[model samples]
Target: MTADHTPGRVTGADGPAPVPAHGPVRAVGVLVPARDERDHVEACLDAALTALARLPPEIVTALCLVVDRSGDGTGAVARRAVAAHGHTRTTVDVIANAAPLRIGEVRNLGARTLLRRLHPVAPERTWLLSTDADSTVGPDWAVRHLHLADAGVDAVAGGIELDGPGRLGADPDPSGCARPPVPDLYAANLGVRAAPFGEVGGFPAVVSGEEHALLDLLRRAGHRLVTGADIVVRTSARTQGRAAGGLADLLRERAAERPVTAVEVPAADGG
Candidate 1:
């Protein structure tokens, strides 16, 4: 899947553009965990809302933005963005976590809220899509997930590209270049089947690497996972980020050092 860097459009490889799925989408929910993201939340939501608007009118789409102990106007900015672009058919809920919660917990909270709102819908039909506040989704993000679900994939580990200068020294090629794959699972761009996600106990409570942890859980459970480049998201390159030991930290460390042989970073399991 080639990413069209154009702000709102994303096209898949060698085919006609994918149309939104027909029939009610059991229930589609986007889970975003944010903290002090006042500068980037609007653009993030703008890109998300545009992708969602293309879904069939009957699909019950919702955006669950969990503001995790934000000191700034993150929640306010998110609410305003939703009001401006969220469709009447879509439900937009902004839930605040008064105390600081780890990334995993924040995402779990958003998922739970979405589950409650979409309770009547069967879990098998429900889809939970996650992205970070600092990232803007491509136009076909949701559409690609739906297509994968239709093709019987239980979860999707989508790819991401650094949006700015900070990048890990190990990164082999420039953004959008074809290259060998690694365990690049990230919450910045991931989607899951609600039933399997619930079965795996959702995201584990971790300070970081929660996305990979969830991927491991799904893999252990024998779910069909699709790791693809078709649904790449553009994420932040800031070194100082909301979570410690995260992508931001790695980027910062790499930027500080000269390019060297990429070290084998251990997975969350310490493998």
Candidate 2:
């Protein structure tokens, strides 16, 4: 939300808009939703760009950063990243001040916009990958998803290793002991075909259950989803201050949806 002094689309009565970073991105459309993430945005973008760079230019579409009405520098940082790649075929741009479009709403908008803009020929085949701005995906992240898709699965879930403020403390709470096996679709490393996602009506609007809800819908619709540790990404352990309760909340939430358990969270590396 920092005064968008660049050059592009003006909101309501705003005179002129910053000329948005030029984009008609053609690769995998990576959509990231961020709020107050100034501290971690750089490394996060680094990982995303690195992964995007590894893809064939024709295969890698555009990386879209959705700024969620944050007063912080998240959007500004995203703009700069896109600017550096703007002069080329791959482009990145900020879809500014989309506040009312909280978490899932903004995410849906970002993915759908890129799907329409970049893949005008066949949006259904276009791949849209979603991740939190604070998460860092591995070098082969995009490739793995593409490979997974090529293998006939409609969706592929990736792995997440906790880091930063999310790491567990030493002398861990005994309740935090059991480590549950990773599931098939962690939001941090999620990827899907654009058509199925659109068909499912995007993610649930509810903040906490949106990702889970989407998975439920996909499963119910008979779309196959496979979770793999090879598709690794690291995530923040903090869940809006619910980290102390550990996986307890996750278990409680999932239990209502299906059978659940208290899987322990291993201490994050470098902890």
Candidate 3:
């Protein structure tokens, strides 16, 4: 395997050490992991490029796409999209891995590649943002996270909304009215500084629940995690998902459990 494609050693979650305060975000890295997402990859890249355009020309930005075990031409599609609509301030890196790796491992690979591309910039001064190939970020997505980082927040956990057919409903009450679902922490909308991320040993190597695991480490280490109410990303609502225990799987389970018409599906709010 080439050096860039080779998997790096994962940092262990050795007991909680004091995480240093971070400085303003001088560089931003957007890590996207895709597997058989040919249809959604272009739109995802477009949305990200638009968001980067909104940032100042001086802020160095990198969009690293790690395509893992995709039968479809997701990697090629991403390259075409970036070549057509890529921003001047943003550099795009597309890495393809045919090995059958889970989403978390693919994400870890993307983070390591991005960090390498943004070298010389201290990890604390760099902001690492993550999103799935099936998700499209808002125009202010990067701005909102960067603002929090500038204010000394170590991480930002944003919310997500399903875009297509299936509507997700929370547990019903005695009155059979489904309560308004609370904003959730979604990997589709998460941001963290490169320093604390490395300190917490990056993401766990699981297919699912890696986001929760990484966040738990941050919390235990006393790192600040600000909920970005204004930073919600729109994710695909298709039932056939790539990850084994992902949103699509949850949607399928919910559908199997109850009648869709019986429960009121919340218009927004999905993890």
The number of the candidate with the highest lDDT is: 3
Q: Quote the lDDT for 83 in model 3.
A: 88
Give the clashing pairs for model 1. Answer: none
**lDDT, model 3, position 255:** 71
**Candidate 3 lDDT by residue in tens digits, 166-189:** 656567867998876633567888
- Candidate 2 Cα outliers beyond 4 Å, as residue runs: 1-27, 84-87, 165-184, 239-271
lDDT of 1 by residue, 1-271 (tens): 2122212222222333333243324678999988899999999988887877777766678888998889898999988888887466778889999866788988999999999988788888889999999999988888877776655566777767777665442445567675544456788889888988999999999999998899788888877666643568888878899889788887777777554433332222110
Taking the candidates one at a time, how many backbone clashes does each contain? Answer: 0, 16, 0
Q: Ten residues in a row with the worst lDDT in model 3?
A: 1-10
Cα shift from native, residue 59, model 1 (Å) = 1.8
Q: Give me the displacement of residue 173 in model 2, in angstroms.
A: 12
How do all the candidates rank in terms of lDDT, highest first? 3, 1, 2
Give the candidates in order of TM-score, highest first.
3, 1, 2
Using all chains and alpha carbons, the TM-scores for the candidates as numbered come to 0.81, 0.71, 0.84
